[model samples]
Target: MREVAFITQNKEKWLNFEQAIFHRRFKDPDELATLYIHIINDLSYAQTYYPKSRVIAYLNQLAAKAFQSIYRTRRQDTNRLLYFFRTEVPLTVYQHRRYFAYAFTLFFIFVAIGVVSAAHDDTFVRLILGDGYVNMTLDNIKNGDPVAVYKSGSNWGSFIGITLNNIYVSMRAFVYGIFGGLGTGWILLQNGIMLGAFQYMFHAEGVLWESVRGIWIHGAMEIFSIVVTGAAGFILGAGILFPKTYSRKTSFKMAFKDGIRILLSTIPFFIAAGFLEGFVTRYAGVMPDMAALIIILGTLGFISYYYLIYPFIIHRKTVNSL
Candidate 1:
């Protein structure tokens, strides 16, 4: 493109970025960094395509200003934790919202497959859930407490163990993106299938409502975190599979950073799930039906709103402000 055309095309965006920096309109450091990257790319193009033009010098000056704005040290905010949850995570989620959709679609499809297979084959639940688990659950059902397995351990011990296990699972889902997301998909498939078969087993035994009331208190958060981690894996994998405007190395580095943040965001939810499972799920058999429903639905609603709805709300506000 001609120098004039290039300048005309990007001038408005550059001006907006300048206003964002000078007026302090950016939502967070991440947004500033993103703008800086764009500025750097524009500067590179100017140098390469219009080296002798005044636009090159102008872009260099603009890029330098943006760099300083982004990297300059400022007093650390005391409310860093609040800022992260309120701004950083939601912005990142908004940016990669489609990956969340992809993860959910893949998981649901696997769940459907599991449900169909289990319905067709009597041994399917055992295969998916493992013979030992199926047998133990069968014994529990015979003894009149199908979910009694949750009551096996001390509450605090179970909480710690389950929380640690969930963290490990999420990390695996994230790190396995090094395999370009197949590993993460495998993890999701395994979990989704097990969930489907397990639910089917309870339904076949005529205790679907009982099982849901007992399991979903914690399962809501746990399952949602799993799906989010799957999305994180896909974000990482996409860095390799589809680098778009960036080099593969650059894309992967960016993806890894964002993926880490996304994975970290799930820790609290996992802990909450652990607490519910360790304490609440054990009493699910005795808990009032209405109370159980409230817990399950409330947890589900919180996860859905935070991960799915809040991001879009933040995005819209940010865009409108810009």
Candidate 2:
């Protein structure tokens, strides 16, 4: 690229970085690091092609300033928790939003397959959910309470156990990314199929709406968190599979960090789901329909906004600001 053309093309971006640094406008470390990476790439290009030009010197100085700024700001944030939820996670989500879509698509497809299979074969639900569970649920349904299984456990014990199990499942989903994402896909498929078949069982028993009111009260957040964790796994797998301009190690490291951040973001939601399952779901039978709808739709809307809509809004705002 010609020096003049290069400068012209990137002048606005460079100026935005300058303004951000000088005015202390950067909102997060990730944003600053992103700008620093772009500046360093430009610096490398300038040094290679404009060896004798003033642009090389200019880029070097700019790069130095960015490095110093990033370094100086690199301290343990006292509000690390707040900053992570407010900025870091959202930005990371925005950057890898496509992976979220991929995960959801894979899960939905698996769910459809499960529904169709269960519809055709009476034994399919039992196979996926295990014969023991299927028998227990059948007993519960015959006893006039299909979701009575949820009500059997002590509330606090159930909360603690469910929370731990959810965290474990999420961690498993994330760690399985080491198998090049196939493991993550398997996890999603298993869970999605189980869910579809479970719902179908209720439908077959003529209690589909009753099951929805009870199950989805907590399942909304629980299922969505699982899907998000799957996306995290794919993010890590993609780093190993397609390193792009980065070396495999570097790409994997970056992916691992981002994936961990994304995975961490789901923890709170998992806990909430657990709480709902332990405390609220037990009362699903007696709870007013409006109350159940509020919990179910509210959880769905919140997760959808944060994971899906808010990320896009944040990305657009960041771009516009730049």
Number of the top candidate by lDDT?
A: 2
Error of 1 at 303 (Å): 1.1
Tell me how many clashing residue pairs each candidate has.
Answer: 0, 0
Local accuracy of candidate 2 as per-residue lDDT tens digits, 228-298? 99999999999899765447997798789889999999999999999999999999989899999999999
TM-score of each: 0.80, 0.79
True-vs-predicted CA distance for residue 139, candidate 1, Å:
1.4
Question: In order, what lDDT does every prediction score?
Answer: 0.84, 0.85
**Model 1 regions lying over 4 Å from their true place:** 1-77
Candidate 2 is scored at a TM of 0.79
- Judged by TM-score, which candidate is best? 1
What is the Å distance of residue 62 in model 1 from its true position?
A: 16
Model 1 TM-score? 0.80
Residue-level lDDT tens digits of model 1 in 172-242? 99999889999999999998888888999998998888889999999999999999999999989988897
* Alpha-carbon runs more than 4 Å astray in model 2: 1-78
